[model samples]
Target: MVFEKIVEILRNYKEEPELEVTMTSSFEELELDSLDTVELVMEIEEAFDTSIEMDGTLLTIGDVVGLIEKAIA
Candidate 1:
């Protein structure tokens, strides 16, 4: 469910018409920059009513999703 939600968030900012979102999709392919990532993290925190302490290693969309899922679980 988190992955699906993440995909929806990605779709909101999808700049390229050809980009496809799936569970296996990479974050780099979404063209998300640092600001985007921060915004996304904030959105996720609000949506889930939780806080996520992220490190610099969350460089990809999938990594963020994975972290979210882990936090939720």
Candidate 2:
């Protein structure tokens, strides 16, 4: 459920109808800049009703899913 939500958010934020977003897809692969990442984090937090602390380790969609799980757990 979380992964799907994240994918939706990514798609909406990226506005790339053809972009294939998956768990293994990295922010680099998505061409998201640091500001874009920060904005995405904000959107994720709002969607999940939780907070996430950004770090260097959050590189992929799976990494963010893990973070959201940990945050809400």
Candidate 3:
């Protein structure tokens, strides 16, 4: 469920349904800037009913995926 949400968020931002949502995909390739990252984090938090600290550590799509998986777990 979390994975699908991540993919959906990426797809919504990219406006492309064909993009792959793999662990190694870079957020930059999806046209996600710092503001987008913040918004994504907020959305994920709302979806998961949890708060996530947006440290400077999340640098890629994989990082976001990993964080979501960890939060859900």
Candidate 4:
């Protein structure tokens, strides 16, 4: 579920080069700008029906997935 939601967010920016998302993928590799990150955070909160106070600690796709799971749990 977490992976799916994250991929869905990434798909919104599919006009860019194709990216192969993986647990180790970084946001830099995906080329998500600040606005995109904000939208992603908002979409994630809406999708999971929870608030995520994002910090710089999350640095990879796995980190995001873990954070989302932890928040929803």
Highest-TM-score candidate: 2
After TM-score superposition, the amount by which residue 40's alpha carbon in candidate 4 deviates from its true location, in angstroms, is 1.1
Question: For model 4, how does the per-residue alpha-carbon lDDT over 1-56 read when each residue is reduced to its tens digit?
Answer: 88877777767655533557888887777787666677777787787888776778
Model 4: which ten-residue window has the lowest total lDDT? 10-19
- Please, what are the lDDT tens digits per residue for candidate 1 over residues 1-73? 8877766666665644455776555556667777777887788777777777866877666776777878788
Per-candidate total of colliding backbone pairs: 0, 0, 0, 0
Residue runs of model 1 more than 4 Å from their true location after superposition: 15-18
lDDT of 2 by residue, 1-73 (tens): 8998999999899887667988899899999988889999899999999998898888999999999999888
Of candidates 3 and 2, the better by lDDT: 2
Please state every model's RMSD to the true fold in angstroms. 2.4, 1.0, 1.7, 2.2
Per-residue lDDT over 29-69 for candidate 3, one digit per residue giving the tens place of the 0 to 100 score: 76778888888778777777777558888887778778777
TM value for model 2: 0.92
Worst 10 residues of 3 by lDDT: 22-31
Off by over 4 Å in 4: 15-19
- What TM-score would you give candidate 4 relative to the actual structure? 0.78
**All candidates' TM-scores?**
0.72, 0.92, 0.77, 0.78
lDDT of each: 0.71, 0.91, 0.76, 0.75
Clash count in backbone of candidate 1: 0
